[model samples]
Every structure is written in structure tokens, then in C-alpha cells.
Target: MKKILKACLLHSTAVSVSLLSFSFGVRAQTPQTPADEISPPVTDLLFGIERMMGSDSTLVETALEGFEEKYGDAVRGGDHIQGIAMTAGGQIVLSYSRQDPSKENCSGMLIYSSPFDPASPNRELDWDFYCETSNTDINNPPTGLGPEAHPSSLQASGNILAVGTHGGTRFYYLGPNGIEALHPNTAVLTGGRDSTGLTYNPVDRRFYLLNSDGSTAVGKNTIRLCRSDQDISLRQANQAIFTDSDCINIRDVYVSGQGANLIVQEDGTLFLVSTFSTRDLPDNLLGFADDNTDAIWGAYGTRCALETALLPGYGFRASFEDHIYISELDFSNRTADLVMKRDIRRTQAVQTCVDKRPAFRFAGGVATIRNGALLGLWSGRQNPPLLSLNDSYEFAFQDLPQPIKSASVSEEKAYLFRENNTYYRYTDSQGVDPGYPASTSRNWDFDVEGDDKEILGAVRYDNGHVYLFLEDGYYSRLEKDGSTSPGYPVKITDNNWPGLAPYAERIRAVINWGNGNIYFFLENRGPFGGTLLGDGEYVRYNIAKNRIDLGPRSIEGPWGILGDYDTDITAAVNWWNGKAYFFLEGGEYIRWDIDTDETAGPIRTSKYWPGVSDDEDITAAFRHQR
Candidate 1:
């Protein structure tokens, strides 16, 4: 029912989010693995030759042969390898699922030993699949139960693992001890179905979730959060939920400057940048006049800002902190906070540099990691935008041999991770994308991964590597130094992973909890199910142990994912002080204490703003600095 539909919209006399043309690729299907069959390793590799260089292919081939020799029998016997995670200690956990009839949304989990040492006591530990046996009815399933039990994302703080399951449920796995349900078994709070994206930032100790779905009568989306130490299940019946609805449909979410600021990309209109705190996630909405005199065009991928140095003459500087810089298709624009500060001619050079990318392809998104440094990616025909700011900022677009679908910005370099395609890394002292370079030690190809495609969700950059999750059901890791292994693609199904794949259609959501855990969402399309893997599946990739833990089945049907199909879930997680936070697609959000691994109370948000209708959508989330 949910077509590859981009919302069709038109703005009023003022500016609005335009439905820019999206380059659509055919969704080709690979040979399906029967319930008892295992997918060929070679079948999982190869999309572009760029990824098959020298030892990379050999590494993957060797790993595949080893897996087949020792584990191939078990895989063929039936094991659903879903998602992965890497821990701070370097333990990698691989999750697998198996089907069961005890519950409608049944699933399971298997913990792999540490990748650092398989002989270590932490080898693959097969645990009983945690099914959705909670006694809750669908029409009135308990708070966190229902067909939407697909565990969307997982976060670990201290020794506790906080599982943000489908249908707005928070399942807490207290490490060696056991599991505890954090939220109440009621539908009043978690907007019925599974909300989309969820993330937890370690530094901030708060969780963030984006709210989608048509529950609220008013249009526009809502963003919510929960603290790390409080018990989400003990909240009152009608407590005032903490949320910021000032922005419309939030498409993508990002937290950077180490929680000093938050950014949300709403459709193709505004890149809302704001500051986050324990109290509120407010965004300063600068009112635009009816006249077109002071209006700026909404660039789909870039953000716009005015130079702070030029704001003193205008009263706008008081309302604004530093000058804001937003990106445009042809050029970048800067507006002062106050009308008096509007000396556009003085800051014209800055604007010119912003638009000077060597390539003119559609700049899809921009991310700032350490400080003012940023990396920009293009959608398809567009070019990558690179900008480095010192005393005088510089902007340039480089032409890559291949088009980059999505990218993540890191401290010293920019990682261009693609889906169904090869991967590349570009380095510029100026922090700009160096159009596909001819020769740079910084080049590694991931095209060897099965049917390389532009990755849908945002790529995640953490520690020293970039994790590329493509739509072809494969996830690969590439080091910033330009080292990549052939796609060690893993498969997911009910037989292998019981709990998380009930609705197995949509498995694109991913978030990296800085401590080494990788959280992801999967779709569960009820008994009848949707497109084979269309239902959401919640997955985790343990980088430390090289194993997976898959379960916490969804009881409700599909409709539980957050972010646009291609939006990165990592952007939603915010780390502040000693906590981590994230928001779901349906407006339900939670937080975790990095120090305690405890969940604070759940935070609910109103579905619609005053002027918005239930039919509208959430485009993005950003912070309005205090």
C-alpha cells in the first residue's frame, strides 16, 4: 500500500518544501533463499569493481569460505542473520532469527562471541528467542505489545541494553541479569503502531525519536525525548510530554558539536538547526514577511546562514547567536537576524564560495562533525559540496567517478558511503568534497558487495570507520584511511532471527550508539505480511564480538519506522553530559543514562500543531539554541 511515494506539496505565497525530482532506481530482486537454504557468499558480494581491489576481495572470500566450511551447514539448516553491533571493548554481536508459532510476531536472538577472540568465553551464545508473548490485545495490546513488536533500535549504557522496540515500546535487557519492560502496557502514549527512527547519544544521556503516522488530526510531525535515569513505565496518565512541534515534517535528524546543537532536515524546505537541553528542544522560527524582499530559496541538501561578523549593525544579531549558513542549488544565502544587519552585499563573497562546488549535482545533505567543519553528499546527478571554515571559509564541489547517494561527515575526512554502488573517501584540508579524485591513497571500493546500490539511510561515522548500510540487505565497514573489505553481507529471515523479522520488508534504519552498539529498525507486516522483507526488523551489529542478537518480536503489524526511507537513524541520537536520547517517527521518544544504563521516564508529544492537520508529515528536527 505504501508506494515509493514522495509527498506532493506546494508552498503558499511564502516559501515551501517543493517535491524536488528524486532519481528512482528499479528495485531489482536477487535470488531468494528458501527457508532451509543458505545464500551464496559470492551472491552477497559484487556490485561495482571498485570494491574488489587486491586483498579486499580475498579477505571477504576467505571469510566466506571459512564461514561456509564451519557455519555453512548451520546457515543452510536455517538461521536468520539480521543485524550487527560493535562494543566499546570490541565485542561484535551478530543477531539471527528463527520462526515460531507460539506468537503471531514471534522471533529469536543469538549472541556471537567477541570478534577479538572467538575462543573467549563470550563465543556465540545461543539464547532462547524472546517472543512477543506479552498478554496484550492488538485493538488494545498492552503498552509495548502488539503486531508492531519489531525491535527498531538498541542502545547499551553501562551493562544495560535499552531496546527501542516497535510500537513505541522500550524493552530493557539488563545484561547478564535479565530483561525488564520499561514502558507501561498501554496505547494511550506510544502512538499505536511502530514509530520510525530512534537514537541515543552517549554524551548528552538523552534519547531522541521522530514521530510519524497519521494518528494526529493536525498535519506536521512531532519530536520527543526521555531522560536516561528515569523509569519510562511509571509515568502518569496525562502528563505533559516534552516536544517541539515548531517545525513541520522532519525528514532527517542529526546531533553534532557534541550535543551543543541539533539539526533536522525537513523535506526540501528548511534545515532547522537548534540547541538541545534537559528542558526543551526549541527551534528559533524566523518569521518571513509576506513580501518576497527578504525571502531565500529552500535548498534541498544544504543549510543557509548569515555571517555573525556582519550582524552587529542589524538588530537580527540579538535574536541570533552565530551567523547561519544554509546551502542552495546554485548558490548559498546568508540572512542577518535583524533587518538592520541585512548587509547582503558585504557577505557576498561568502555566498559565492558556498555555491562554488566544482560539480553541480544535487547536494543532498551536509554534516558537521568536530566543529564548523562539514561534508556534503549528492543525491544522483548532483555533485558533492565541501566547505572548510577558518578565518575565510572555502567551498568547492568535486566530481566523483560515481554519484554519492548519502554521506557522513567526520573529524579529518568525509566518508561517501553509497548503496548498490562502490564506496569512496575524499580528503580536503578545506573539508570540501574533492570531485571523484583520480588518485588518492584514500580510495577503497565496496562495489564488490552484492549489487552495489546507493545506501538509503544516512551512513554512520564513529570511532575511525564508516558503516555503509545499503538497500540490498548488506552492511559494510570502510576505514577512513580508504581500507574496505569485500561486502561481508549478512542475511535476515524468520527462520534465522525469530523476534525482529515478523515484518521483514523495511530494514534500512540504522543508528550507532557511540559506545559501539549499532541499532537498526525492521518492518513487520502482520501475519499476511507486506513485501517479503518490507515489515520493519530491529537489528544490532556488535563490532566487538562479531556476533548478532536478534529478537524482541513485534506483536503489531508494520508502520513502525522513523525518518524518510533513506534518512539516517544516527542523526536522531543525541549525547549530552552523561546521557543519550532519541525520538521515534510517531512522536514517542526516550533517553538512557550513559553512566547508569537506566531509562528515564517516557516523553510523549502532541501529534499535531495548531495549524497542522493529521494529513501532513514530519520533515525534520533541529535545535533552537538557548
Candidate 2:
């Protein structure tokens, strides 16, 4: 019987994703009709916060409510919101300059930050952005722009913020306090002339600036990409290099800087910040607030890049008025890219600033409209598999003083870890035997220093043999005489392992599903170049054929009564109960019934599993014989 367990991991060392620690107040999760949300009228609407998520240049909208009333109207760019940049630490920067060369070129940039770090005191900023430009002008300014002129666009990465203008693009220092609006340094790429629609790529440490053909042909434009190696806010020289997709005209249609708005993700994948016109959708069906733009945008396609895609690039207008909205796009359909609003945010707990789709809860069952069509009254994934519980555990796990690194059933159940290069041998009869937790000296080809020496995951075969997985596609097995199998540490190649080779580097855990097949969980990272790489997908390896038998599939459900989880499914064990028990990052356990393929209980380990903490992370789990 598999424990009613369902946890999915999205954690990785190379990716550096901030764990979900933004607990501001009592988490009041009122289960309601799943739909888009429209926050109450906020005085200072700072930014529409966005994060580069998985699923091919996908952008997830987050709700951010509180704002400084004094900073009202600063974020209102009126189609002139040429650039919106986000820092690695979750700071949003917006640029809006008055297009008129008439008055004193007065412009301001507003920054909103909820530093992903839970440690810093200011990280809990109550969702406010400070206005520290040369001058301050709020609601009183004519058209709210307040003589705002060019710094036509903006882009950011790490701690550096770049502001682009018709003359040239300059860099500014973004310290912890606020942006150094006073000091402006020039970047080498934009020193000669004006540039707009710029973005930063963290993957390769390069800056991609959008260059247009400077035409006014309606719905037609030619755009290219400029690569800069100099670090942000630095003054260096490098010519604009355009080749392949960079040189080719994505779509020879449009005016100056009006093709597809450029946005490069951390993984160096290029995408367009596309939008849709939603004026025709019935006001009742769309459920938008009184104050908003005529259009809604919610997609960044995987095929909008220059070189590879044949379908035209350069997105259409993202908004019709000052306050724009975002909607979900149906990428699979591949027809009309845009869709109307539906509160997918409520299901994901995504807080945002300007998406007023509607309250998640409706009086009755609601109809989710997509692409001007009804998606039925039922909610999609109403709730991410929440491993929540009404009952509390009386006792906590005390055995694992340190988090388990790699666990497998072997001679006394081997647990190889990196705490000073040692492993623990726990027995079902006596628990930790005398002189346990010994060094990994005897493990052949392992027992080295650094990352190569660490065991990421371990699994046991029916014969009671143990296998240890290492970094860069290598694995070793234990022999009968308490020694590693000779000629071990072999590469898990396509010829040998077939289905698991390409992902050998990203595998976080392995499981021997007592049913004669092995399961491997793959780790995923975000916005790699063009797609969300390192997707947390799992594959089933058939022991009989020694190749992939089932999937490279997502843990999201329809998964045999096993709902998906937002957290990472770190480790699992084929328990003695004849079920597969899975463990998550937070000490929660669930199981899968081998016979029925039905799943049950993501109950806290504190209930039955001895010595497990509430928030303890389990790295490896397996059944062992004494």
C-alpha cells in the first residue's frame, strides 16, 4: 500500500530558487471559486509583479497589495511604460518618460521590492516601492506623467539597473536603500545613440538590446538583437553583433520600437512581452474592475524568437489604456494566442499588483472564459495538492540529526551523506549500530572530495543490492563483501540506461517501485535561454527492458488519486506495507498502493514515523533488512 503521499520538489543547488518563506501574516486561505483576482483600489499601484516561471518563457503573476499613497500615479505609464525590469532578488523597476521634448524633461522611475530573502528586516516591505528620483510628482501632475520624458526604457539584473533614452542608455547603481538616481554611468553598447526595449540575461551574463528598423508601417516591423558582455552599470565598448535570428527580420512590420517587446529570461531564452485587446469581451464575462485598460495580456510564447521560428515574431499591443491586465494564453491550441481572464492566481496563491480579474469566490459556480469561449463551471486544479493536515503529531522525528542525503536498503540500510564525507548504517532491530556513521572510504571510485564524492540518491533492487548515484551521470553498486561492485562508477549512458541518461545530471531521487520498475525524479530550473529548463518531471525506468517505459511526465494529477504538490518530492521508499511511501521537503509523507495504484495519506511523519521533525527534509528513503 502506497501511503497517501504526494510531494513534488522544485529545488536545485545550481538554480538558487528562493523557498516559499514569504509568510507575512496569518495565511488566510479562503477556499473560493477558482478565478482571477482584482485587488481593491490601491492608492499607489507600483508594478504588475512578474516572475519567469517554467513552461517556455512563462510568466507567473503575483499579487502585491500595500502601497504608499504618496507614490500614486508613479507607475502609470500610459502605453509609455517602455520598460519594466526585475532584479534577481524580486525588485520591480518601471520607466515612464514624457515623449514631448517640450518641458523640462522630467521623468521618474519607481521601484518595488519584496526581497526574496526572509532574513533581511526590510525584506518584509509590506509591498511598497520608494520614489527617489530627482523630483517627486504624484497625482497632481497633468496626465500623471509630470513632464516625464525619456529614460525611454529600463532593464535590470542582480543589483544593476539600466535606463535607456533617445540619446544613449546609462547605468545606475541599485543599492539596498534604493536606486542611485543621481549617478548615471554609460554602457558601451548604447554610447553612440538611443536604444529602447532592453533586457538582461543572467544565464550568460549578457545584455540583449532590441534594435528596430525605425519604420512606421502599421502592424509591420523588423527587429534585431544586440549582445553586450560588459557587466551592468559598467562602461565598456562592444559593437552590436547580429547574426542568424538576430539579423533576420522576425516580421517586417511596425514602427520604432514597436515589434514584440523584448524580454530575456535568466536562462538566456528570448521571449516577447505580448498582450491582447479584450474590449469586445462582455464586461460581465471578463469580470474586470472599473479601473483598467481595454486589453489583457497573459502570454509569452515559446516560438516568438527570431532565428528558429517561422511563425511571425513581434507581439501586438499589450494594452489599450493606462491600467493594463493579463490573461492566460492557450499555448497548445496554437491558434489565437490570447485568452480572457480567469483567476488562476487564486489556485497558486500568486499575489499581484494590477491584475483585477475578479475575486476567486463567486456566488455560484463560475464559468472560466478562455479565448472568448466558456471553459465550463468547473475549476482547473482548484488547489495545488496541499499536504495540509487538521491533526498534529504528538512526537517529532529524533533519529535524523542531519538531513538524509542518500538512503538505500543495504547491509543495515546505507545512508551516504556529505557531513564530513560519511554515511550512517541504521538497523531496523537496533537502529544505529555501534561505530555507525562511518567514512565512505571503502566505496569504490566514490569517497573523493567535493561534489563528485557526494551521493545524490540511492535505490535498492529486489536482491537487496544497493546503488549510489553521483553527479555528471555516474552510479555505483555495493557488492556482497561490503565493497563497491568492481568497475563501478559507470556512466549512465543512453546505450546502458537509455531513458535516464540525458537527465542523469539532474536526477534528484530514484525509486524501485516494487512492481519491477524504477522511477527517477528530474529537477528543473527556470527560463533557460527560451524554455524553463530542469522541469521537475519524472520518468519510469523498466528494469526488464532497462529503458524508459512510461514517462518524463509532470507530477500534476490525474495521477492515480495522487494530487500534485507545490513543494519538491525529495525522497521516497518502497515501504514494507507493500506501498510506495513518498517524502517531501517539509517532513510530510504520502503513499501509493502498488496493487490498486491508489494513493493515500500525506500525513505528517510525526504521526507514525519515529524521530521526524515537522519541517525536516528527507533526501533519501528505502526499506532495509537487519
Return the top candidate by lDDT. 2
Regions of candidate 2 where Cα sits further than 4 Å from its true position? 1-68, 73-82, 96-107, 116-130, 133-153, 164-168, 182-208, 211-218, 222-626
lDDT of 2 at 107: 42
Per residue, candidate 1 scores C-alpha lDDT tens digits across 1-626 of 00011211111121111111224345375422121111001111011112211111100000111222222222211222322222222222323333332444334332322222111111222222233334223333333221222232222222222232334333333223233333333122353232222223323333333333311111222322322222221122122222233112322222111011112222221122211111111122444443322132222122334433343332332211112122111001321111111111111222222222111111121222111112221111111123221111111211112222233333444333222132223343342242221211223333433233334333344454555444545445555443454543344344433433433335544555555665555444445545444333455656564435644334123212232231222223323245444444444444556666676433442231121112211111111111
Cα lDDT listed for each candidate? 0.28, 0.38
List candidate 1 segments past 4 Å from native.
1-128, 135-139, 143-150, 153-166, 177-192, 195-626
Q: TM-score for each prediction?
A: 0.24, 0.34
Q: Write the per-residue lDDT of candidate 2 for residues 219-299, one digit (tens) a residue.
A: 223444455543422321122222233322333322232212334322344443322122221233345554543332211
Q: Which 10-residue span in candidate 2 carries the lowest summed lDDT?
A: 391-400
Task: Tell how far residue 250 is off in model 2, in angstroms.
Answer: 10
